[model samples]
Target: MTETTDYFDALATALLKGGMAEPAVSATLADLRGYLTETGTAAHEEFGPAGEFAARLAGGAPAGEPVAEAETWKWTADIYVDRKHLNAYGDQGWEVERIDRLGRFVSRRDPEAAMCWEYRREVTGIKDRTAMTEALAPEGWEVCGQWLYFQYFKRPKAASAGPAAVIETPPEAPGRRLFLSGGYRKQLVATLVAVVLCAALTAYAVGRGANVTAILIGAAVAAPIGGLLGWYAVKRDVLTGAKES
Candidate 1:
């Protein structure tokens, strides 16, 4: 039928399949309804009523099955020093400990056995920074700015006899940061020059017997309007550059 109806139906289907906590799902839907009404989107405004109806149906439906165990896990690798051995190595030589699958640390001495206070482990497959941070907090882990040094684990090869090799995948490269293009810079400079010229013209006109106060006020007003035009020119140039790139 309508777009709003379609959206409502899709949300209902997702909730049914996902088995999300009912109260949270209901609250999220209500918030979405309010957002739609505020934004005055025709589809969302009309969809609100349909969503309410679907929400009622969902409330009575059986909860879906519990989520399956994660197929993958991620671990944070942090460097720590053994304070007990500090006197021998000046500052206790640094050691790299691997945060295990359960968010616990495992000593390199015993990779297969769980070591107390040596590592951290938690559920894995986190792609966002917030979730990753939360997972690592129980262990003395903190994000070092934007970079995260972590490891991921997957299902073990049940039949393999050899030790599991930790696979290291390179982090995704960031997009190139953009600066204002030369064309936009030129346009901005031109606009500033035009504004200055316009002010000088208005001053000269006032000096030549036009209403001085009115000329000055008019120049002040025209400067912003001229600048706005210049801003648009710069924006257009930027868009053209983006398209070319």
Candidate 2:
């Protein structure tokens, strides 16, 4: 299998086995899929073609071209999470704490941006934490403690005089709502159809009467199994729709 396909399959399997709540797992998987798609598209554009790049590198050609490609790869692979929203909450006297994937905390306080700190004693990156902190101090941010936290504070926005605008919330489509709400009904209909089809197939096998015991057993086992699978599909779809909504 291709590297991308293998990575995706592994991620899917991990998602399936992970003990996270269903909604969280589904959202996480969706995010990962979107990231992978974007990454793949960027890689393809930069590398021209994966197969061509691999062949050229394998033949021990000049390393200059591949070195340039490596730099491009690194640029695209680096992912940064923006912390601007933390400042918004800070302005409201709400202390915000955000831990990145590496467990580095970013926090902020109210009304004192200069007192804010970005702790980096235990964190990687930023060779000179003190200098970094000093530079950010002007912007009401700082670093402090061993836990690598970035903190800041800001004033809240003033309230406006007129009436607040009415936000229009979109209504759910009728057909979509019906599909989501009729899970049990759909399952029942599918089960009945399976039973009828199994009965017909079993009758045909009996009419032949030519050592059809195995066929009968197979149909008996398959009928309920198929019906259960169909029910599961419908139920899962409905659950996913509800979660998304």
Candidate 3:
């Protein structure tokens, strides 16, 4: 019963967050509550995941219309895969409202297929971040959000004078992905080095003429390096294939 109530409450919150009117959201929740009461069914059994359900509702509506302050809006749950991914959607006329540890939500009134957006991401401190933003301002990427160590920036599609030049992703996307994924590669190398060092130490220690001094020295160096790498890998959640950094 508690889980069911929590699920519906979360769904209601997401709908409201997506730009549905309070009365509309309230009415939807009320309808669900009544249905559940009459049928005695679990919320998940009926509605599925709240994020996906909200996405379906958001998608069903028309988009790409110019919005007024009081105009009804719609939002969908978005995956956070660095700023490049979000920029691709911006190219399609959507804009990110906010993104945090929980999830990302982007809003659009009337989405246009021909439009494009560009984005850039960086990891830096306040001083460097300010500098980076200032530099990017001329190119048109506006700072959007910062999640953990990463900062996101975006800009609307650039206008083209030539007969509607085809819009495409920025040429730097591949390079950026390689750069971001490089951290994990370094950790992987460190992990492998640790394993090989331990193996070599084990072999030397068990040899016919084992040297205690060599074994001790190897252990001292290997233990710290291996321990540090292991701890970092776990902290980065590399095993689960989460964000690389």
Candidate 4:
């Protein structure tokens, strides 16, 4: 068989294996054939390897799900840890599943990079924690994850009413004020402070001829306390911002 014929045959085999109906596969192939004939484009040049194309086409349907080309869906984990971004994805039918430790939002949809709001509050004192969560729950917000002292939540995308709803400003959360502001800058500052304190104590001990053993012990304790505080603060802020959407 010619390469073109071989390519289609492979694609046909793959489609069948991928659970596509025979009639639908035949129709798809017929349309592709006509496109190739009219454009005078080599199948490989226009469509790349047939196996790859077939696999990609099959991806839209997923296992046990029959999906139309117009309703073809894909997964995206490109969401940031924010409600606005999650909501934007929600608007388009994407759902936020979880946020990783590093604050990346994993969402599943039939689509692309999306923007939505995220709101977070640290599960600080019992009073703030209960009030914040109980308050947000009524406003279509759902908890996604809780890391350290942080509580993550997202607002689902608004339903479309004809023309896509202009993305709305994220709702305000009462406890949002508790979150530390600044992005990575806040974390960097905390880390820097820890390092500086450690270095300064070490330098002071050396210059003053202080007991090296005692100095090292002090440094070890001080550094970690500083570092942990910093780390906790950042984690708290991250979750707070993520939910604040």
lDDT of 3 at 84: 40
Best by TM-score: 4
In candidate 3, which residue pairs get closer than 3 Å at backbone N, Cα or C atoms, i.e. clash?
Answer: 63-110, 63-111, 64-109, 64-110, 64-111, 65-110, 91-115, 91-116, 91-117
Alpha-carbon RMSD, candidate 4: 15.6
Alpha-carbon lDDT of model 2? 0.37
Per-residue lDDT of model 4, residues 1-245, tens digit only = 39889989988987777767798689668766866765466888867787677755554444345544322222222113344444445555544454443444444333232323344434545346557777888776666644445566766343324334333342222222122225544566768876887788789879999888998888778777877786676565554444333
Show model 4 residue runs off by greater than 4 Å.
1-63, 67-94, 101-103, 112-140, 160-184, 200-204, 228-245
lDDT of 3 at 141: 71
What is each predicted model's overall lDDT from 0 to 1? 0.40, 0.37, 0.55, 0.56
lDDT per residue for candidate 2 within 62-111, as digits (tens), equals 32222111100000000111233233222323332323233322232222
**TM of each candidate vs. truth:** 0.26, 0.24, 0.38, 0.42
- Relative to the unseen true structure, what is the C-alpha lDDT of residue 238 in candidate 4, on a scale of 0 to 100? 54
TM-score of 3: 0.38
Which is the better candidate, 1 or 2, if ranked by TM-score? Answer: 1
The per-candidate count of clashes, in order, stands at 10, 11, 9, 25
lDDT for each residue of candidate 1 in 174-238, tens digit (9 for 90 to 100): 12222344444556678768877887897789778999888878877887887787656645543
Q: Candidate 3, residues 1-245: lDDT per residue as tens digits?
A: 88987887777766666666678678557755765665465878756887666544444332332222221222322122444455555654455533423333334323222235566666667558779888888877766655445567766555433324233332221112122345546666877887797878678677867887777787889689778867765545522435533
